[model samples]
Target: MEPVAENKRGLMPGGVAKRRFKLSAGDIIFSILNYIFFTLFTLICVFPFYYLFINTISDNELVRTGQIKWYPVGIHFNNYISLVNVNSLGTSVLVSVGRTILGTSFMVAASAFVGYLVTKKEMWGRRFIYRLFIVTMYFNAGLIPWYMNMSMLGLTNNFWGYVIPGIVAPFNIILVKTYIESIPSELEESAFIDGAGYLTIFTRIIWPLSKPILATIAIFGAVGHWNSFTDSMILMSGKPELYTLQYRLYIYLTSTSNLSALMNSGGSVNTSVLNSVLNARTVKLTVAMVTILPILLVYPFMQRYFIKGIMIGAVKG
Candidate 1:
């Protein structure tokens, strides 16, 4: 008998040809359907922002008439340009930037440190303290009492109000604590053997290792600070200089007279033409675009860490 012909495909242990895997018709159909579904989903999610954007750039006259859907018509940048003329716009932008940076930094550092501390077996009442932190996440004093607390603390109209009250974010601490627990205790033990103090080990070792979760916390804190106008509305009502970008934008969007005044403030632009070119519709859309741009720009940079941190941090908690 002729020797068995060697299989052209890879052989199994018994010298039988291995079956090649292939997608069935159902899989191909499912894949096509999946692609279609996600594509439609993506467009649905993205269309509002695109619509907002086109309206801001389109002819204000056409925008007001709702004729600028799907694509921009008679595109002009007058809406954005007119914002520069709004009083305190520049100051509000600075205040917003300042609060976001400082608030995020303080929140991240406080969360990291508190998270690390709670992981220590030596700390007395560590579990109690951590549980207390978690409790705040579920409970809140009414707005009236909260406002009273802020006023009593003299945080109202104070820049520190934005930073200080949010420093110890309970949810962030929980995430950080859970993430830190997943780290090898051997590392901390080794540091302890090397005459390293808790602070040194934390600052030198834990901090670096905790970047993923810290970044997640930072994004959360920054977005909270950037988007929060209610705090500004309540606390900084007396302090226009401390007004945030969101608060200023909120005021402009709600007040037609403010929009008109903003257009008129641009002396170089003829009032008659400017009024038609930069109306309430265009200004509202433009402010919405401006308010959203910073978070959009920043989110992509931290998304990888955010995903990884959330997944790992959430594993235990």
Candidate 2:
């Protein structure tokens, strides 16, 4: 027998050879094209944020003149300092942080609990309850009606406004419900046989086993809350103190009169430092980064679980 080619075989026990699969020419070309496409796509997707970051660090004049591209020119760090010095900075940060934590926690717990309840066949009105959620996915009260309802509930200008209405998310409930259904029924049966109550079984079995989906949903909740400015804009309109960081940034960018007044403030602000920070080109770029930076830092930690959970939850078992 002719000896097998080294490229076509892998050595096994006692020098026995197993056939090694080789990529076809088409496969290699397809892979190369795939890599090139994704590489270009990534650059396209990333360049805007990169542009914002580099412009943020460049001199305001250089940025405005559109001369600073590919690299930062006349580097300056005072934009960040100016952002920190905003009168509402402390309050905005506090509100954003508080709402993000509280909102994420409440939404995750509510979604998980509702998801678990729906997965139980013995639950009362299971079909009706699930259909109710499905109905929400397709239909929504218009903005005016929603605003009126919230007003009726006295959620306007309330701190709970940030955390309450978002607690019951139909999409999150569906993702979590699908994930929970994929779990083995035997586990719950075993728990029930050991005299475990519904809450106990959920806390002990479901919660721990559901980490991937939970982490995915938690990241969603956190990002949604962190980036949420519309809710603050409408619900907390009367309360400047409750404004989130993103909304504060919005006010800073849009209110030219306010920006001018801030730039001219003589008290506490050093003339040179204030001048550096008040530049339109720099402040907006820096504030944009400041608003999104936390979410950017957080996503990497959750990315692995996010991918896994989303893939698994997409298919109903």
Candidate 2 per-residue lDDT over residues 118-174, each given as its tens digit: 998899999899989989989998999999999999999999999899999999999
State the C-alpha lDDT per candidate. Answer: 0.88, 0.87
TM values, all candidates: 0.86, 0.85
User: Which 10 residues in a row give candidate 2 its minimum summed lDDT?
Assistant: 4-13
lDDT of 1: 0.88
Off by over 4 Å in 2: 1-10, 13-28, 256-281
Q: Write the per-residue lDDT of candidate 1 for residues 64-175, one digit (tens) a residue.
A: 7788878988988988998887678789889989999999998999999999999999999999998898888889898999999999999998999888999999999999
Q: Give the TM-score of candidate 2.
A: 0.85
Model 2 residue 16 lDDT score: 77
Which sections of candidate 1 miss by over 4 Å?
Answer: 1-20, 257-278
Residue pairs with colliding backbones in model 1 are none
Q: Worst ten-residue run, lDDT, model 1?
A: 272-281
